[model samples]
Target: MEERLQAVTTPVLLESSAAGFSPWGSILRAIPEAAGDVPALLALAVEAGETWPRPGEGRTSLLFELLASVAAIDVAAARVFEPHLDAIAILSQAARTDTADQPAAAGSAGGTSWGVFAAEAPGARLNARPEGAAAVLDGAKPWCSLAAGLDRAVVTAHTDDGGRAAFAVDLRHPGVRCEEPAWVARGLREIPSGTVHFDHVPALPLGGTGWYHSRPGFAWGGMGVAACWLGGAVGAARDFRAGLLAGADAGREPDQVALAALGEVDRILAAAMQYLARTATHIDDGSLAAAGQSTWSEAQRVRGTVAAAVERVLQLVLSNRGPGPLAFDERYAKRMADLGLYVRQHHGARDDAQLGRLTLKGDCPW
Candidate 1:
């Protein structure tokens, strides 16, 4: 296991150098120009999944590598694809029910992508009820990514017993209705996130009510999102470095103030990376659970740290580069916008307060 981790980490470390960014850049460029191209992106994600880390073990290193790789090229694409990968990660730990009631594991219409629609917003009330030997899903699930493209989804709905449960729903079923895309934000606009309505759609419960949120893997999955955010931060920092190098090559000396800001950016990002590594190690050693620390608390801490680092990196780059990248560099601009939007998922001060409350319960492992 150590050998496998070293094999993965070595390449990531090697690629951290200026000369090594091209490999991942090439991979991103290889993606088709079509936005939200599920079939194309899914193919890439499936290829990446071949090397996905095993279940119930420490996957932080591999997941961080993946998110960083994909996000460096296109964070919007990462937003669209990560959920599918995360759904698979969640399914690995899910309580399996009768196989007779399970949907076929194959992709929908031969496409390889999947999605998770578990956000329980007040607008859509997806309900699950027992129908004979099976269960049926009804109502809408908002923030459903890859809705029109994916063949299946792990949807959360209110069960008849008034508790939340996760169900594997086949999007190909007649009762599953995908509303037209409504997202207009520039960031993650390429992702086909919209409302999916289930009209008595046949469902297979993956786990019992409340089990989806209770699993340790659930918190691990949240940490995966933070990893992606850190990757985006890296991408942004890389762009800043490239700009500085390009100026130097042209006999232009960087401003002293700008250089200082860049130094600070480096410190911020480096600290976040180190924190991520430590957190991953903790998860792997089982020290977090052993210490009676909730995975949710750890995830929140990591997310908060990464989100702040990304924000600082973005601010410093813009202040130093003076909007040149945002105005002239398409890739940099997209990464900036996408990361800004993605990190908003972190919930800022509210999450920090939650972490504070959780910490006060006992000795802080952090």
Candidate 2:
């Protein structure tokens, strides 16, 4: 596994750097060949834990690097097309039964944490709407990581039929447009997470009738997003460490504190990664209810951990540097902001309610 990660790291890194702040094209081209290695990225994420950021400036670096590899391999096609079909079939089949628990695996979808994270492309929820489908969409996806210049985007949309469905839309459709947003975000800025507009555009359906959220892949996708966020947090932690330890005269006391904090962060990330892996496996084994219940809680836990770690490191750095970090350093400031915003995606409180319903009420509502 180490050998595999090392072998691919250079190619992805070179491509990411050359591609610069707008490397979606390279990512798209790389996907078909590198899709199989996604699990490797997850393993790396788990191994790096929260300390991965010590080596880099923030989580965006590693996040984009991993995504670059995924795009290099083209996993999205399989994730969206094939698994979507399977998920729909399972959901439809399960719906026919008198009991909702007949086969809890109705929502399984392939693709590791990478696919899951990409699913949360900002405005995904909005794009997959009836109005968004029919009308001209003028809004932008603040951080659409792999969206720019892609051949196709499998986005969620509400169909004319009044049901939520994932649709495969051509990025170059006459009505479609992609541009970087003019606003500033805390991290992941290189993602081309700009705006995509559809002027009464044409699109193809991704799954069957009303099978969007009902499918199991949606939940799996959510878990995947949480995993990626965890990876970024780890990267940020690493960066913090490297910065603190770079100077020969750096104080040992702060290093000791950072190291201890890193250990706690590692524990939290490890638990989150395990939860994600177990959740994916449970879905595969026909245990959707168990997977869903656990996923909600895990997502929240991961976010809480990441937010806490980032904040802690930020505070420590501020105390040590005495306001140097606030001098508009894009990497540090943006990262802090991004991590803070990204944690909200974990659905922590919402997941708490979901877990309560699944565990205490003993029911799988979906």
Candidate 3:
């Protein structure tokens, strides 16, 4: 497992360092202003979408590679890219569903970009009512990333039968309105995440009630997000390593303490990669199903592990390097903030409690 993990991640790191393969450089060049422009970031995402993993192309491998590459460059940019990839996956599944009357016009005219707005919060009621041939979505959906920028969205709303349903919404419609006062945070400001009000906006329902949540791929997608977190951790590790190397070159050799901290970072990251590789293989081989293990359980475990690993990496880097990276280096500062914000997407205590329940029930395979 260790060998396999190293094999998958090492090459990606080496290739990223090679000439003519600067994903981060390309992102900076494309969006030079970094003005938190949604449309511009979406455009950059669309252009780079081709480089992402395609269907049936070892999604696990590509996911790890992408997280490592993009996270190293800019985790906020990685945040943008992660949703695009997930939207593609969700839309593809929607396309395959028997409920899809016509083809899902995802990447059609007007350069449509997609986002998943499934975060459920009270006071923001996004309910779906069947009206003749289409579903009418009314009320507001909150925590919507790239709300203004996304041309289309896969939204989760309450159905008429008191069940949850997923729908494809066209944000360009007249009834749809994206609210202002986007997320105010230290990092990931580039993601224009806010509330979007739907005044009877027409939508296309995907699959039947509960299909979106019940699908195996749903858990797979969650693990993909974990991959992004792991990648961001790797990026942080790289910054620390670079700083140490520079210090060494300047005749300030890192003592045994600094060396030990670096070693610990490597150990944590290596363990994370090994876990990811094993999980990806299990997902690919349908091992979870065979073991009667729920994908949700597996996803939670992987997410929890990766999130803890990233936090540890950040703490160690700060302890060893002090506030220089965060204060002086703009890119490093952004990476740290972006990673801290992004990883919080995982519910901390609530998720841990759920995982404990799964373990008690003997549902966790690992």
Candidate 4:
């Protein structure tokens, strides 16, 4: 299973890096029509579309599946964009295999940083002037997941030409820096969620800057992050179960607390699956606006539910199962942290604002 996933992932990464587009958008479109050589891809993607806790393992599985799905389609993004698949895989594995560093240099940390998908501000206003483009990058990007050890980032910057433009910059370039200004938290410490600074880093244009935002694929691409979060939730749930079983050997005893936690996890996961299927239908019908609306709404609801369930499961395990589950130096603590952190990626106060505006304005394109 792993080999098949790697086979699909390797080539697309190579091709994408050679070109310049993200392979995610293309992979999502090809998932349904792909050949039957791999069922793991679907299983992993579906699992991510739900919820759980294992950040490192969850990310590895989802990233592999995403790559396979894209390769199945043979999309131009994979064929042309410079591929970062190997880099991503390496980072994810490192995160899973190693312990979270004690909050060190901003971008040097490894782990969940690789397996995640992050985006810059798509709608921020930028100044357009031949002289202004070189002065500075004047905007804030709230969610850059793999800001550490990033080689390149596709950023949307306002140019001096009176319009927005997107540029892909090699992070190793002159002006780029990763800043860790404290005030970050979650159950998992592996995600190097920090700021990527481009103090006038030389930017290579990626199509027209404004065009990137208007593209249907660009908007649809945001949903891919939700898929990753869902995968984490599944891994966490599995760990939670193991912890439950290890705590006092409650085998087949129908422990009320464990049963309740399981029930909550199951319910949230089911809702997430149905929501994903509905969103997939929207994609099939070529109604991107509809898909975005559904995707956004479902993401908001599901993220909150999953986050709550993960917390509940942890409480149940810790309270009922006791601390023996932690004796083996396992990753339960980190998994919990990872899930909590990743879940907030979707269910933030910003989502509430968007959802509110969507409700207020009946003119949603969907």
Best candidate according to lDDT? 3
Task: Give the number of the best model, judged by TM-score.
Answer: 1
lDDT (tens digit, per residue) of candidate 2 on 1-366: 655333332223311354453433333343334333533333333233223221112233333334323322222322222222222233333342121122222112321121111233534433444443233232333344434433344455544566655554555566766665664644433332455666666544445546656554445444444444544455445445556665535554455666666566556545544544444445455554543455344334434544454455445545554456557654455555555555555555566666565556544334
**lDDT minimum window of 10 residues, candidate 4:** 74-83
List ranges where model 3 is wrong by over 4 Å.
1-38, 54-57, 96-110
TM-score of model 2 vs. true structure: 0.53
lDDT of 4 by residue, 1-366 (tens): 655343333322211242333434444444424322223233333233223212223232234335323422322222111123332222233332121222322333221122222354555333323333333454445455445444444556666666676554455655656667364564433334555655655544445546655544343344444444444445455556655555548565657767786777667655654554454445446453543454444444544444554455455545654566555535555444554554555545676677667656653434
Query: Positional deviation of 354 in candidate 2, in angstroms?
Result: 4.4
TM-score sort, best first:
1, 3, 4, 2
Residue pairs with clashing backbones, model 3? none
Model 2 has an lDDT value of: 0.42
Q: Is candidate 1 or candidate 4 better by lDDT?
A: 1
Model 2 worst lDDT window (10 residues): 108-117
Clashes of each: 0, 28, 0, 36
* lDDT to native, each model: 0.73, 0.42, 0.75, 0.43
Where does candidate 2 stray beyond 4 Å? 1-148, 178-182, 192-195, 247-259, 287-334, 354-360, 363-366
Give the lDDT of residue 118 in candidate 3. 91
Q: Give a tens-digit lDDT track for model 1, residues 226-296.
A: 87788777777777887888899999978898789889988997788888777777777888888887888
